[model samples]
Target: MSWYQHWISFAKRLVHVVAKPMKQNSGQGGVMVHPYRGYGSSREVFVMGRVFRQAALGRAIPRRGVLRDTADVARRIFRRGLADARVDIRIGNNQLCITTDRDGYFDAQLPVSSALPVDVSWHRADIMVHAKGYPPVRTNVEIYVPPPEADLLVISDIDDTVMFTGVAEKLKMLYRLFVRKPHRRTAFPGVASLYQALYRGKSEKAERPILYVSRGPWAIYEMLETFFQLNRIPVGPILFLREWGISWRKPWPRRAEAHKRDLIDRMLALYSDMPCILIGDSGQHDPEVYTEVVKAYPGRIKAIYIRRVDQDPKREQAIQRLRDELAHTDCELVLAADSVLIAEHAYAQGDISARGLQAVQRDVDEQQNDPA
Candidate 1:
């Protein structure tokens, strides 16, 4: 209890406190980036950052209408700030203002935008930082913008084209799509870049619009967006089927359900006035559906680019029927190993010089050809 002893104890405690680990939040919402920790256990030498998704005040319920198991998901980060230090995240089309509670977690109300009824659903979210130091940082809001009017429309699939969902093995693809986490899915090569090129539109008028017409259900929109953002891919209006009803139990793997066909009708209506390019994969109903659409609207469709996933002779014959039929419509139907070549050709048609589109196309081509 001597004064000298008390001072000694205070010094020891200060060192321990400094050595304790700490975590903070980076400005990006929905992502956390930790620095690399060294041998030093000095907590003061490091910093941490976290982001959170929160609901409106007194509205503990997530506006998405789904109940989250926990309001907060805690993640640990070792070091502090560095290169690309902030987590890269997307501001979905529906994100709005945010607020923070005493604990420094972000909570916000996700806005409901269009009421347009299609099997096609959209998701919106905001970025709010939750961490120990610094005030909550809110990222500039960017909503998902649908493709503008174009001379050509691009509708495509997900599995086997954008993400490897084992479409070659139907049962496996279906199971993975329904059961896997967002982090588990693998994006197909050059898909993100191809999509971006098709969507960026050349000269606004010559710009060909793109649409993601996939058989995947809507339950994984967040995951889909995560994949796109993480890989720096392009964004577009995503069309998916509802999996909550009898649709799940349907035989033949995928039946042309009323909801799905109805969405196609809606899509056709959206492009009734413009000619379009249909980019699709042969893994599912795309061949049957795209073939029918091209047949119904003859000259309105510019071309059909079908990605072949199944090597089955019977299935290949069926897909070839659609390709053969495309000739009748005077629409060129070409098959490529992946979408990059087709997308490159589309970009060239859009008045974007070959050189103008090379950078993106190169990246896509590399991804498609890369062994890994």
Candidate 2:
């Protein structure tokens, strides 16, 4: 072709590229799926994600530089929720569909006639979603099954138990939540080691199930997931949360204690055959909720470990009362200020190896001695 002809062709291509933003930002949208994790014996599978239009492709993080990255990330998250849309997904041979609630997040629970193979710690299932007028999108979901011959299941709260969120102080809590990136967030001293010991139990190879329960919202799923990854904490399915957009219309959001309670109840029902170890904090109703769990399913609870975060005497006494109530059952409840003590309990209960116990104590001591 002549130079003039080539120039015309190049000009046309540049125009298309420049005009692409207009077409994209004109409110065109599609389906997205988050990583779904759930236990296997329940025969229940859950899929959750959002459908977005206009701005889903671009995150609104106000990244001026490193100094503002964390805050920017928070702003992006605040801008991301409350989108309601219809989504249809196929898991294996079964097709399940649902429309998202006002939160723009869809969580579909379906009992499969045949279990998806879960020969590993997590079974990955590829799912295809169909949204009319949009090209198909595929995402992976994981179904976790308790290991055979496993001794215990661990259900833990995230905010104060695993990490320090200052949950008792709302303003500070929001500041921490919005200002710290997952990589920079703090993990409670010796927590990851203790959880690892409990997960390994007597056997280093043991993959005892760990399910994380949070009162936060689904919008921060990726953030929490990143936190777990960065801190090397063993994580399972995370359950129970409101949608995560900050709203001025509703200044005070609905409490999620009930939602949290419901999830624990379901976990117990699903893992009825396995005794569980519950880890939460005194910051909220964990003690009360777990006490009810112990009563509801006698002998199903192996131990209840509530971290002493609030440091309120009344709260400690209240947890003590809950422990006393469980005396009739085999469950032992421990309310303490450090995870090292819990590691000792786990060791005595034979939930972890002697070496694992040593590791937990050592990590705790090291953290205590760290100048930072």
Candidate 3:
């Protein structure tokens, strides 16, 4: 072809490329705001969310078809992170803007100038997230305003601690995660009642905040939510650790240890006056991590409970060493085999009432009879 003809063909191809839609990371469309439960004292409010276009990543799992379920499982197990999106949020009269950094997550700690009701445990506000291409998305956000009656806060790990997640065994963990519905999954005996009692704390009406931290990817957030609801556990902010991505500038996604520690630190700093109870299983880094947290803030931790999930002798010894190490501190480390032990300790500390202890015992007995 002549030079002019070749030039025209090149220009046409360029136009086609420019006009095509951007390659998307996930299948679904539309922008979404996934705000985690935020808690604050009366003077200020803190809120957080991930700004992203919907990918329908877990959409097929709940639809009840073999092929669709298989696809959803695959998506969840190998889910990709959608990141680096711009977002805007407005809480009450305070407006702030933040940009997601390679994780599609944004959080703002805004001040609450308006007066909050004295008795309520939660404060509601509208949170709006916007991206350049997608329309502005709005969602109801709750800033947990802890009541003055709250004695302490609870931060627990979900995997293997309360839920029977074979976290130490990769294949088994994947199999269980893919095959079961949220309701079908098992919660440890009496853990729900224990959590309820902790949520109610010293007073029967006090709804003290409970935060859940997990090492799993965000793809399973919906299923976890369903699981919490089905089990009648008190709902709180579900924080997840990122496990994808490695690069020259940022060598890893939110590192698991750092994520857990940073989140715990944030909570501790936010509620400086209230102590925290740390709970996790021995299958992973609970002992080591909780020990580090205790060391970081010596008097701030009220108690630490590491469930004995692993039967290994060395693991038990390590946890026992940690317990001994904390002997002089204000906190107590209890490595227990059942929720009964945890409930008993809480009762002794006046964290739960005698009636609440009885409820926990009843639930534990029922779970033994029928784990269904």
Candidates' lDDT values, in order? 0.47, 0.67, 0.71
Candidate 3 lowest-lDDT run of ten: 16-25
User: In lDDT terms, which candidate is top?
Assistant: 3
Q: Flag regions of model 3 displaced more than 4 Å.
A: 1-30, 54-86, 168-185, 246-254
- Model 3: lDDT equals 0.71
Better-scoring candidate (lDDT), 2 or 3: 3
lDDT of 3 by residue, 1-372 (tens): 676775555444333222222122233446656676676776677777666554454554444334444443444344333476655655556666667756677767777676678777777767666567666666777777888877788999888887887755644443333344433346788888999998887677778878898887755565566567767888774455454555798775676667788888988887888989999999888888899999999788999988888689999988889989999898899988989899999899888888889988998887687655
Q: Count the backbone clashes (under 3 Å) in each candidate.
A: 11, 1, 0
Cα error, candidate 3, residue 227 (Å):
0.9
- Per-model TM-score, in order, reads 0.53, 0.77, 0.78
lDDT (tens digit, per residue) of candidate 2 on 212-253: 877776655655665677667887655545664457977765
Error of 3 at 266 (Å): 1.4
* Best-to-worst TM-score order: 3, 2, 1
Best-first order by lDDT: 3, 2, 1
Those runs of model 2 whose alpha carbons end farther than 4 Å from true positions after fitting are 1-31, 56-86, 91-95, 168-185, 244-252
lDDT (0-100) at residue 1 of candidate 2?
62
Quality of model 2 by C-alpha lDDT: 0.67
- Greater lDDT among 1 and 3 belongs to 3
